[model samples]
Target: MTCQELYIPKSLANLKYLVELNLSYNELEGEIPADGVFSNITIQYLVGNKELCGARSLALICTCLCIIIFIYWRCTKPTSLIPGTPSMKEYCAISYYELVRATQNFSESNLLGTGGFSSVFKGELSNGTFVAVKVLNLNSEEALKTFDSECMVLGMMWHRNLVKVISACSNLDFKAIVLQFMPNGNLERWIHSSTTPYLNLVQRLKVVLDVVLGLEYLHHHHHQVVLHCDIKPSNVLLDEEMNAHLSDLGII
Candidate 1:
């Protein structure tokens, strides 16, 4: 086949005593069979098929297979062996693979927002619990510190006006904090979105009051005084009932 568009039949490898196969100048785009007739063919017989690859293609396939296996192993492996702190004991431990599955491997569509040191994604756990996963950028030393700060602060505190911590996944390579998922999203969206219904004066007042309560608990009610260095409309999230809850205490 000269200048024709076709794939070399893999069955050709099964032919006994078959030799001198010439598949030059054809649109053969895939791994060449490494058996039988193919094993005997030289570069001359398969010349001009730029898309055709041999050992390189096999190596690529092998690499892809390895990646798939690695992903599968991560997903199936249990996180029970990982040690947890006293605060972590209060909630169920989550594995890195579960977070991967929950967020569809951190697909762009599942992303809720991006910040300086991390990105937030909406996900659902295997137990059907909806959660917001704040994955920290491991590359940044500040992000690592943020992860530690949030874990230390959120794990010990609980207030209705504050977003609750579900669990956390921390490893040398990856760190993520799981928090209660707010369906209504942040206060910034409500204030900025032209498509959605605008908040009335009463609703606005209630939202402000909710934020004040959350801040009050953090500043005074807790056993230790915690300062929320960053407080903005975007940092305030709303639950299903439109009740506001302050979040993102990474800099606490």
Candidate 2:
């Protein structure tokens, strides 16, 4: 259901026991408040499209005792952030079954790119959410180690500068990671694409700054120390807004 204002309807009151309210793909606008009698509601998804003004929940040591901060944090800014993280939990993640459907059983057409360690594919899952899936061979001990290390490290962190893990999927035969989709593809592709506008020196500099900032964040800031051992131009991706996203750090 979609709600877009100060005075939400009383009809919604009937859904008092609803667990997952997905109002993500909507044009909901205005401030999000904790007022009203339905204040008990949780897991309210107002993402995808909206001009939401406020939220309430977490605290600081960054704490406002007068108000609770919104834990449903979404990044709306265009400025690229950098976090040099050695772990993978800092991002979102998707389930294994979800990946199977998204990639049509890992078909070749969905293949976006590939590397020695894994192959990347374009995917739109059962929930109609677009994403990028990276698959590693199930038999390789090295790949297993990389995936486990990433999950342990990345599962615990979250930031705009870091590439979000949608979820992880595994089977006796293989394993994979689901990540937020990047329509613009990666920086390496754009840097050489004949159909795209070339990034000049200033643009390159800015991108480099973005990458550096991300690395710095990973190294510092986060709850635990992170080190992005794997760093290069290809590991950097750009989204629709030209924001940078780092991917495929095999660091343990």
Candidate 3:
């Protein structure tokens, strides 16, 4: 049996007297838990999981940031969920395992869209909060750059006309940015899909105005003049109220 993306859960380390664990020839990601049976497992047992690492000599040395993020998740479990909350760093520090579970292991049914280097999936958190998880393909350097840029920029800015980034998740095999899911979808669908009476002139103007306002904030109100290299119908999302909000700032 081959698993595309396997996360060695923390609970597996609890197994006692389970010797001779052989996990070779399987695709695995994230840190190898350095407790319980895993501590004694040899490199031969974990071969081919290039993304797996920890205190084990066979694995790569985990960065301080990754370790810190893991520790935070291990210690803290939020009791409630609220919109516009200020737990940016904490909320963003999520595990690939959590995202997989949230999105039903990235089932095709939850897939929203796919770009040049990533696929967006609809996810629901344990607290019933919805999010759009943009999972990037790490094999592409451009995708990595986009992920980094989006995270840095989104962390620093906020505007009603602009899409909101709620949190982020990163691991050896998985990297994603969690965003506020737009219920109405993007402007492209309304414009191209065979929907009822096309957007009236007033609605069209409102969408244009929303895009202009979002761009204005990024270019003028922000500390720096941010440029969105790509602005198209698909990138302009609409909320439940049909209010347009500019999204996909990865290339900005």
Candidate 4:
């Protein structure tokens, strides 16, 4: 057993950044605390340790997920599912566990940036695909409303220039939206970072064009007549080819 079965306090349940439980070869036994600390440290690595025998945690989780999925599947009349095809729905409703894993327990080192509503962090999934997670700690009713409003608006736009929303997770009062990673980071940094070359007028003009084109599409082709309510240099992102994208479209 290579993990620590510490007395995971229930008070720490809201903290999403705690990772790594090296309980290794401990003589601790008898029904591990199932919530808070114990719940997160579910992976008990047992080698030649006999004191590790206990009720299986994986079974409980599987059962819970199955139940939840069943209920959600039943209640939510999925307006998705194309005719005569697989139901591998796009824009999956990301789970808390997935979000945690992606953000490396939401570590600050993985943090890509921050803004008025939340902070953005760079993360990679089990599949190695990099993603950026925007986490907003809604401390008040007003913040929650704003979060909901932004989420609702961003959830609809799928334009090339507009920022893309991969998925979202709301768990334990923590709200987060996962987006595809912009390898070059924000356009503001790319154009201004001392480590990078400064953008000439031509490059800047191209970026503006891309940003406006995205907004135009949102205004016209998008499902909703969306507005790029918040537009600034900091909100633009550049791709590998220097193709500009308008990022972070929150609500008014």
lDDT of 4 at 241: 73
Q: Which 10 residues in a row give candidate 1 its minimum summed lDDT?
A: 77-86
Residues 1-252 of candidate 1: C-alpha lDDT, one tens digit per residue: 454446677898999878768887765777788888887565556767778777735554565576568556643443212233236568889999999999999999999999988899999889898899999898888887667767877788777788888899998899999999999999999999997788975577678767777777777667788888779989999999999988876544
Q: How far is 71's C-alpha from truth in model 4 (Å)?
A: 51
**Model 3 C-alpha lDDT per residue in residues 15-78, reported as the tens digit of each score:** 8877658888677877788888887675557778777765673443333345457545533533
User: Residue 90 error for model 4, in Å?
Assistant: 4.4
- For candidate 3, give the lDDT of residue 121: 97
**In candidate 3, which residue ranges exceed 4 Å CA deviation?**
1-92
**What TM-score, computed on C-alpha atoms, does each candidate reach?**
0.64, 0.60, 0.63, 0.60
lDDT of 4 by residue, 1-252 (tens): 334553333455455665544555655553444454445453333322344433434544565576568545533542322243212145677788887887889999998887666888888887888888988868656657777666667766655676667777776678888887888878778756799887764466567767767776776655567666678778888877777878776655
Runs in model 1 lying further than 4 Å from the true structure: 1-86
**Candidates' lDDT values, in order?**
0.80, 0.65, 0.77, 0.66
Residue 27 of model 1 has an lDDT of: 59
* Best by the TM-score measure: 1
lDDT per residue (tens digit) for residues 1-252 in model 2: 435353334565466565444555566555444544335433235444345444422211123222223211122233343446434534445567667787997899999998877899999977788988888876677777788777676666556656787777767776887778888787877776788787854456557656766775676665667777678777898877677767776564
The TM-score of predicted model 4 comes to: 0.60
